[model samples]
Target chain A: MTTVFKRPESLKDTETHYCSGCGHGIVHRLIAEVVDELGIRERVVGIAPVGCAVLAYEYFNFDVSEAAHGRAPAVATGMKRARPDLIVFAYQGDGDLAAIGMAEIIHAANRGEHITVFFVNNAVYGMTGGQMAPTTMLGQKTETTPRGRNALGEGAPIRVAELLAQFDGVKFVERCTVSKPRNVLKARAAVKTALSLQIEGKGFGFVEILSPCPTYWGLQPRVAMRMIEERMEEIFPLGRIKEPAAEG
Target chain B: MAEKHLMCGNEALSEAAVAAGCRCYFGYPITPQNEVTAYMSRRMPEVGGQFVQSESELAAINMVFGAAVVGARAITTSSSPGISLMQEGISYIAANELPAVIVNVMRGGPGLGNIGPSQADYFQATRGGGHGDYRTIVLTPASVQEIVDHVILAFDLADRYRNPVLILIDGVLGQMVEPVEIAPPPAADLPAKDWALTGCKGRPPNKSRSLILGENELLEMNRRLQEKYRAIEAAEARHEAVDAADAEILLVAYGSPARTCRSVVRKYRERGYRIGLFRPVTAWPFPSAALAECAKGASAVLVVEMSAGQLVEDVRLTLGPAANVLLLGKPGGEVIQAGELEAEIDRIIGLHKMKRR
Candidate 1:
């Protein structure tokens, strides 16, 4: 019998520590599928950021380095510049990328470091008990935003995909979500394009995955998916925001 | 020996690092260590190594952390305020067990002090500047030639112990031009770093991190670090003494102040005063035992520093009250004049003789 579905060789067999119904797990699987498809699993070195995905190294079956909070891009820049032979990528969360590590990510992209960055924006700080994040939507109630995030008190959610797409160093930028099967397929494709850009010696590639956090959003698993579709997607639209020019 | 040439201390260090097989440099601009970043920006590209001018000192150190994870010979340089920004990354590098060289061309500080030289960072460098109970091997090089030698030594020791090595110089040593020999790269027999993260082509995947979520695991990690520090302290402490055995007055110093103490020792020796100079090359392992040995016949030990007696604390810790430790300190941005230091030396010896009579 021909097997149609199986775990990617790039993903380990161990169970993940991510919460059930979380979008991170789905996004992780998509990245693994792309890594296997591209046949670049052995030459890939992943950087895990300090957030919900801090333990991502355990699940990715390749060389991985755990970065300090918000410094993954800087780390990836160093690695890629030194090796250039290896495929390097950074897995980061909203707090890790948009908040404390803003300077690092901006500079890395501006410098045109040839690396892939998979940014998961769940809108709430999941591992840190749902504290307000940089991408946290205004009027959303979080641990720090107990009375609901006020636009005057807190800024509006940051559109990272659009912000990063403006840099000349960045060659590809996409925003996708995994709230449903149809969207998951698009996200999977986006992951492939981002990784492929690096393989093609293109500059920085950024994919913002508008993921779901059932535990922090105070909704059922299915309902959390709906919230991503209904609310998060409003601020973070899903589609390719920027793409490298087609080769002749 | 390579050809001798006139070189500034910061530029010589950059050339020495390139010769030492340094493969990557990530840095930000900060005086008086700006020459290092500028020199590396030019030299690294010429040698086919990578150089990145990071957005800030914090980013530079993390970039060093990244290069180190891949087993590259990575380095970063900055002055006092910039080094303060680097403390967090340094702590992470230490915990992650990465080999990196951090050069702090210290200027006067508690703030954006000045571009002038000072040794006030003694306590910060020696006492694990950032958080945690870890230690970094600190090397205080006094002159242009010594800075070149110590830059190479810093890299070797960093890789040897799998810990960060800090080269602490003040603005004086960082900028002054002097004639020095830039040597060729030695045939270094460094140990194999089997732990570096270079993709798992045919072997099991490698994961390197310092986050110990388990309390017991963190305890074990701390214990292992302590053991390694003990090993480093025993084997790596370096010091020098001139006529220490026959001295009644021992003047101890490091970095730029040591250069001044050398001249003071010569002037006192010409006057037939039993004086000697003790300079600690490696500040973290501290040369404590070696210093106690050098102070054996001395009646008084004076620590000459650019700070408020920071280095004197370590001397007192090594030799208690009987060593009669004195301080000839210049707080923050100024250097100690040779005339003042000489006068202090005379007072220390005169007081010792009066007490004996």
Candidate 2:
């Protein structure tokens, strides 16, 4: 008998506090697997943002620092600049990245800070009870948007990956999902690629993961996953929006 | 001993921070303190240190937070409005117990007031401007030399207590040029940063966090912080007294006003008047007990400030009617003139005489 399947060594054995069907747990496992595979668990410093994944410090066995809302990029910038030997990454939510933390994320990327960003776009504010987020779909009816998100009033959902891809500092920009097995594999690969780019001293690598917030979306876990496949994918197409330049 | 060099307050502070082992600086450009950012940008890279011109004061402080969490000596500088934006990050740094230095070259306040000198941020700096029941060790520097010395002290105190240290100065001190003898960094021994987020190599992962979601955990953390504050208060309350003994009248001030008050005291003493000056160095600890002790022999106490009576309240609380504690304020970028302070002291003495009669 061989031990084929088990928890990644980089992830803690304790159960996560994330809600069931939430994409954070799967994403956390994917990051942990990547960290373990790269053998950089001892050199990685993860920055947890002020969102549903705020308790990310508890799940990752590697060192983690908790940053204020929308300030993870700034924090990661500080960490990487201060200790260039360490691998720094920031885990941010849609509201954290596109809304409150807009200035921080943009400036960090524009400065070409050598760090990685894991942006989770779940459409709505899951931790704050289904409020209309910057990435919320136009027809999505959140608690704050009882009549659905009005594009004229609330504006269109921000395409973060595409917006960030335009920056010269950003070397790689990819949007992926974990709603299906194939998508999950793609997301895993995207995570690995982002980390590798950072490990190679490439300027700012960004991976936007379209996650599911079943608790806030007023749908079953499976239905929320299906929403990612059917609707969310239409707005946020899954693919690498930008890639690093080839070496000579 | 390093030869005396002519330098502004901001440049002196930046040079001193480098000497004090502050290997990282993250700051945004703000008026009256922009020189510090520029100085750090040029000097940090030369010293093999890192310097980043952050997007905003918000980003700068968070960057300091990140650097400090990894056991690096980090600092950020801003003026009044920029410091307001940094309060959120400052509170987080305080709660996480990270050692970092913050410099506030204060300008007039309430909104985009002016790029002039003002001590209006006294309350905001000393009274826990950000959320929570935490305190940052605040040191007010009066001159270019003091700014250099206090910055080195700020880093030491921040690391000694694992708390943020703030060096408060007004626009006058920040931009004024003077001959300052920069001392080498003090060889102060600091404890190991065992709690820093330096990765988990041979042991469990370390976490640098300020959030306490548990009800009981937060309360316990607050209690622990209170105890640490008490320890700091007991160990680090500093104030300067000039001819305080046998003085009939005492004038209390700090920072720029204290520098003016020193000259005022000298003039009064030359005229055979028993007038003295009390300057509190550590603004957060307030030096209440030391101030009250210095006020024991004085018949009247006059509080001079650049604000409309912020530090006077602390003085009144410390004295508690032991002496007549009067307030003389010049708010809205008005520099306190020595002649005006002298006239105010005369009026107070005349009133005391009337009461005696």
Candidate 3:
């Protein structure tokens, strides 16, 4: 019997520019798989932000547009409104989404633009050499926070999913990780829910994926995966923060 | 046979946009220019086009950005304060080289000035209104009919050069009713945009974007845009030289003030004064060449405007200081009446006759 695991057609065969053990590749593959399964490959437009996934358009076969740092939501808003028939998504890193683009994304969601957002939360700015992010966990060590993040000085990690869930225009909101197979499946489901909400014209949809950057974290791929499974999940927590309440 | 109907300048622009195949209008409510939004609200749905009243000017202009990327003939209209709020999105649209139409019904400014007409935004409109080195093709319409005619030309010029075109009208023109002959829509053989956000349907994918981050890359992008601007200036600089042929004195003005100057010219001509008018149609790549030509024989030039002589500086540059240029106008929401302008012209003419004789 042949194992049927394969790369999705929505992703090109080119190798990514990410460092070894960086979870960007996995997240990219997951998004590609979702795009493929939904059969919206040709009609999907992705916005690459100024973070680790800034060059994500290089890997995604569909049409892609690059956005200025922290302006992906505004750029995506423009794209979706101009081409309403296209499925639009923004792939952003933690720093890009939470730090600089906070106003843009919040305003976009508040306006209920019909677009899906795939936010990657790795707790650090990977491409810019591991700086602390808004989602950076307490006690996390980064170039900016060399002595580990302090709750008093640096503030606590932001729970974006929980925050976004409060907006009325948001149709779905969830947080998931890619460290384990089960978690990967849940992340895929979250992506599907977001896309489904967009297709139904319900409103804005967001899925934050807890990805790992082993090279930036100074760990091996397996070790990073283990850290995510053992510690990251405990802090980030999994499950849908907002979904339509089922009728009793 | 063309049909003439009485309409406000704002309504004329809306009709002209529809005739020009504009498919989307996104704007917020503001005074003096409310007619453009209201007209679009009624007209857009009739043609299966999209019309949205955005929560704010920021969102409305961003919506214009979105619509423009998808190859839609999109536009937004606002007064000075609202236009200031839209500067960010306009810069983005300019950087991307997306074709869009923006109408600024000039009102008093620097803050929430008033609903009254003022040319205070001359610097903002002629110069790059937003950050970055970009120029919009600015057209000043002095008449309600030209408001219709120029808006149609604005859309054409916007797409022809793949840049934003501003129909810079004043509150008086936007609100005042005048008879206008609405021309038939342009010929059917007009070109189509394949790169617009009409969806990639049955075609190779298209990408519309403006994030040029790389230093060398952005430089090259701007260089290319500069080249386009140079070409646009070469081909599209237009102006009106009414009665300038044998005049020793020339009057320079634009927009509604230009109409007032025209009336001044008519009254002074009847009084045996050899005065002429030079009206700039393209305010940005301004009608400098024509003004220079008209200034050759004139002993002096006067710029009449609703603001503090913004275009007078341009006249000085065009005339090279050989011609004595004077500015007669009011600022802060004051309209220069035709009688005031005529008195100034007569006094200048009388002074010139005394010196020559």
Q: Give the lDDT of residue B246 in candidate 2.
A: 64
lDDT of 3 by residue, B255-299 (tens): 888888888778767777678899999898888887888877888
**What lDDT tens digits, residue by residue, belong to model 2 across residues B159-260?**
999999999999999999999988777589989899887778898999888778886999999999999999999999888999887677899999889988
Candidate 1 collision pairs: none
lDDT of 3 at B277: 93
**Can you write out model 2's per-residue Cα lDDT over A172-247, one digit (the tens) per residue?**
9999999988989999999999999999997899999999999998789999999998999999999999977776
TM-score, first chain, each model: 0.98, 0.98, 0.95
Taken over the whole model, the C-alpha lDDT of each candidate is 0.91, 0.91, 0.83
True contacts kept of each: 0.81, 0.81, 0.34
What would the per-residue lDDT of candidate 1 be over residues B108-135, giving only the tens digit for each residue? 8879988888988989999999999899
TM-scores for all candidates? 0.98, 0.98, 0.87
Cα RMSDs of all predictions? Answer: 1.4, 1.6, 3.5
Summed backbone clashes in each candidate are: 0, 0, 4
RMSD of 3: 3.5
Compute the interface RMSD for each candidate structure: 0.7, 0.7, 3.2
Model 2, runs deviating above 4 Å: B354-357
